[model samples]
Target chain A: MTTATAPAVDSVEKPGARERAKRPGTGVGRPGFAWAAPAAVFFGLFALVPLALVVVLSFTRWNGLGSPEFAGLENWSKLLDDPVMVKSLWLSLLLTVLGVLVQTPISILLGVWAAGHQRNRAVLSAIYFVPLLLSITAVSVLWRAVLDPNFGVPSQAKWLFGDGNLFGVQASALGVLVFVSTWQFTPLHTLLYQGAARAIPQVLYQAAQIDGAGRYRQFFHITLPQLRNTIITSTILMVVGGLTTFDTVLILTQGGPGTDTTNSAYYMYQKAFKSFDFGMASAIALLLVLVASLVSLVMVRLSGYDKMRSTMEGV
Target chain B: MALSLAACGGSAASSDGGSDTIHVLVYGDATNKVEKQLVDTFNKTSKVKAVLDTIPGADYQSKLQTVISGKQAPDLFFNWGGGSIKPYVDAGLLMPLDDFIAKNPDLKSNFLPSVFNTAVVDGKPYGVPMRGTQPVLLFSNKKALQKAGVTAPRTWAELLTTVKTLKAKGVTPIALGGGDKWPTQMWFQYIYDRVAGPELFQKAVDGDKQVWASEDSKKALGMLKELIDAGAFGTNYDSVKFTDGGSPALLATGKAAFELMGSWEYSTLQDAYPDFVKSDLGYGTFPTVEGGKGDPDNLAGNTNNFYSVLKSTEHPEAVAEFLKLMYSDQFVKDQLSIGNLPTTTNTPKFLDGSANPAYSTFQYDLVKKAPAFQLSWDQAFPPAATTTLHQAIQQFFNGQMGTDAFIAAMQNLPAA
Candidate 1:
């Protein structure tokens, strides 16, 4: 080919060289922009944009009918002194604690039991996972009927509490909410824990038994140490899930017998939908995100996650 | 790409559902069939066709607001009228119906004035009644009351005595759906209207912040507290909701002898407990308190649902035609067929042959002669205020707050 024609061919072959040169160093060796472009665009469109908008919306007063107006500290200031907000925050914290203290132990035991019982595994797993398969509405209705004071199990057990309804009284409402939530969510944690438990070498348990270690000793020294990372992760999931509990509480008590079970997530929902105060709701949402982040950080430190990471790096 | 997509649909332009066809959105449920029938009847001869759309009842309100603020708002929509459309009215998003009324005077004159006035916001009509009136009434499961040696009470004293008698027989005196919160608010609305009178509610809704703390209001609170202390609703009423069928089941099984429910209770019972409905159901108006200023004939409940037009609609005339269909004789009959007690002046003639003739006639007469009817408080006040109002009412009923705290909470309701 002639020289001029070859130059023309080269220009066509290497199009947009100027644009390519504008990017950071060694751009060509990295995957082409088009490779991750779809994911980046989708992520930006859905997750990042919504989160950014929520932050912006937190500073405005929008009634969802009219244009949102800038109201610098109005929503934040109102949230600071709000009694419902304070009560809801406490309630959410209580739920997170309950999830850790109650649901974790149940999940661990179930996971351990499921690991040993190969013969009954199918039936036991099916029974445990029923709540996950049932629609939330169905579960809520079932639980409501089961707890009904006039004709439910409470009536037959009248001699124990003497016609006392579990869900009606304010003092018991929070406990009932926690119990119902744990009942529905324990299977999820069980599945998670079972994965970690099953991964542990069977030889280790056999070795511990030969070394005169009991089943409990084997669990504490071998199984628990091996499952530390999984347990930490499960706790984090439970705590965050606890903070955002909504549907179960809403369908069961509607956050009441007078806000007795009003978690912060449900509180934010009420502020947005019931009151049409989107600004306040967004503020509550951002507050929850911040609190959850701080809590996760503290949890990791307390669980020796940093030391674990350092040990892995040293290896 | 997202920006471009939004930009393409940004203009208030229809993608040719036809310039002659404008959509009407309504909350979906059993009532949708009646709405469709009426729309089909209207579409047959009209120049501008009306298309009906429905969102499930649970998500309707939130979805309506989202679509209104976004790009998909309907030309016309269903609403509970008073405070439901207030924000839209304030934002100039709704078209006032005054011109339509002026052009068609029968639209105003055909329905009961009390029911039609529900859509009046700031002295201007923004909505037209489109369905049946739902007046709250006293309902009894007859055999249970008979077992207790009591009848449906006509006065508050007799009601208290009946509660005592029912409790002695191990029956819950009233079936309350406190979990939903709105049903519990019905008791407050009726008691307040009977004690402080309907005007007090009107004034409170009109932005009189001090109205909730008035002497009559305090007195009403006291009487409500006395009823709660007397165990009229039973200890577990807060967890039982009609929406979930818990409270209604209580009434059906004779665990609850009395229930103050909307007139829809007639249809609900007819559907769920047909045999019991035939053998043991009875109804009455709310009982009056002694020395109360309000007339004994006054009632409290939802008047009817309404259709309001969007200001951005291209087919105002089409919306006008659709609204006019709401008052037609055909509309009245359709409402009656569903066991609804319509508020149109012509509704009375069709009642004798409705789904439940006796129940229909009872409600029709109850609403017709009532000197006043209090629209449900949650519907009467601003929609944004409803959460606090519901919270306050629930707290008071659960005995979480004293009378003063309840008064304070009511006074702080968001301005209309």
Candidate 2:
């Protein structure tokens, strides 16, 4: 009897138990679908319905007031010839790249350094989180005021530096817009990166340092690799945010000075509501969604979400 | 679901169609005072209740469109008639008020024929004119005008001379709110009418002539360039909000000598500076072009506000009743007294006689005297072209593109 029990235990320890769990409708199989039904309903109603409508509308013409008429790929065809829309798409793409490439690195470095000082971490996090807490409208209004030619920071700076307004130059104006956007967003990225940096095990750093690795080398060799999933997620979110940016641009510039800073979202709004070309607006929105989805899909594939999930489970 | 929906439907119906309640959407906060007085008086005198639903002008059009297209579009909602109402009317969203108009001899007789004509499209009257606003002359600081030694420009030559004089004084001769594209376009349209005359302007509106490419348009553009060279606009004018631009700031501060804004600007002034209407304000039409067809006295404004009934209504009579209440003597009196120029042919004698004196002058000349009206450029053009006009004007003023390019771009705008 003891020998038979030992054999059964060994069989359970073998990969057979894992295979059984993987089988359909087993112990670790799909749980009661009741738990998922609510979420599925929510996603269906809030996300899929609108997305499906948008996709359908992309193939039609609607004035937002009257019934839509099917136009096949006419909206898509028109998109190829729309210079204003093309320009907006390019700007949104550039903003996304800037958010990930330029903004992510600085935020990660700042976040890691800030995370090192435990005594002041809470206060520092709060400081970094302040911009995120402010409403988009509030943030935009604040920046607009600060960037005003007659009474803003740049104007005062010029006076202090001996001159009239410093806001007239194109480069200066562009710089202010970029600076305001980055300043408002960097803190949020920092908070995300800081959390990622903290979760990195101390043992890995210890072993690296004991082997004569410098702090920077330890970070590069161990800490950075551990934060791969976090970095990817944060960068994706920031890029998405950058691509859809509207309120700030609207409040600050209103796509004015001859459409200097018109983003895709604002362009969509101007076309649909302002000009009453709802069909064209839907086309623009569909294009935006497509581009964002492609970018996210590429990031997900490269980052190995399954591996990241396993690592998260190990923690 | 059935129970809840039934409950909601019952409550909504009771709240909406109940006697003693008539809902009306008013345009802006400034009109809320007058609108409410009318509503209150109507409610007090009759069992039919009247309520004012005032929405900010910025969000009014979009919101109104939404309401009209949905299950509820207030019993009677304010409409800026003409082209803006065309889409709604064409969609069969608005109830034709012809039957009501035919029945009510009082409203028919009270309104000016020209003003009433705007509410009629495709042989159907969908709305009734509440007010008639025309372009009124405006001057900035008396000090600036005195320094320029020009009283007020009565003709094209005098305008140029006065502008030059003001420029010589290092003051902006004209404070055109180029930031608000509509104002700049108004100047162009006014000049175009002056150069091409009312008949041609009518032709232009009918799409028979591409006015943007016409000689009158060229002359108008040249005049704009002249104004631009003379530094007629405020600093960073392209960035200014419509309300905050040249009028309230530059004009109020006396930084500029004159403006050619709508009569509504008077209400704005009254809000900005107390006692403005009573004493400080004056009005005139756009100066007559030297050899143009439009008379200086020939007006370029339409009824800026109209109230329409929804065609979806189960109670068309109620909707008409609400509109009738709006045109009632008490209602017209309250509105007219409060800066609004009532559409009434003879505003009830009870209405305050202190009508915005400047607007009253234009109203007398245009609504009472002018031969025919050239509706506002925005009000006359299709929505797509109208939008193009705004952006074209903005780019033109921003020095982004030349006037020829601007006009050419406008000609290429998609027509309905």
Best by DockQ: 1
Candidate 1 residue lDDT tens string, B219-322: 99999899999999988777677886777788889989988888888888888999989999888989989999888999899988898889888888877878
Tell the DockQ for candidate 2: 0.25
| DockQ for each model | 0.45, 0.25
Give the lDDT of residue B1 in candidate 1.
23
Residue B234 lDDT in candidate 2 = 43
- Candidate whose TM-score is highest: 1
lDDT of 2 by residue, B123-216 (tens): 7777777654554445455655766677887887787778877877877676665545677777766777778677765555556647767777
| Per-residue lDDT of model 1, residues A61-80, tens digit only | 98776667999999999999
The C-alpha lDDT values of all candidates are 0.83, 0.67
Docking class of 2: acceptable
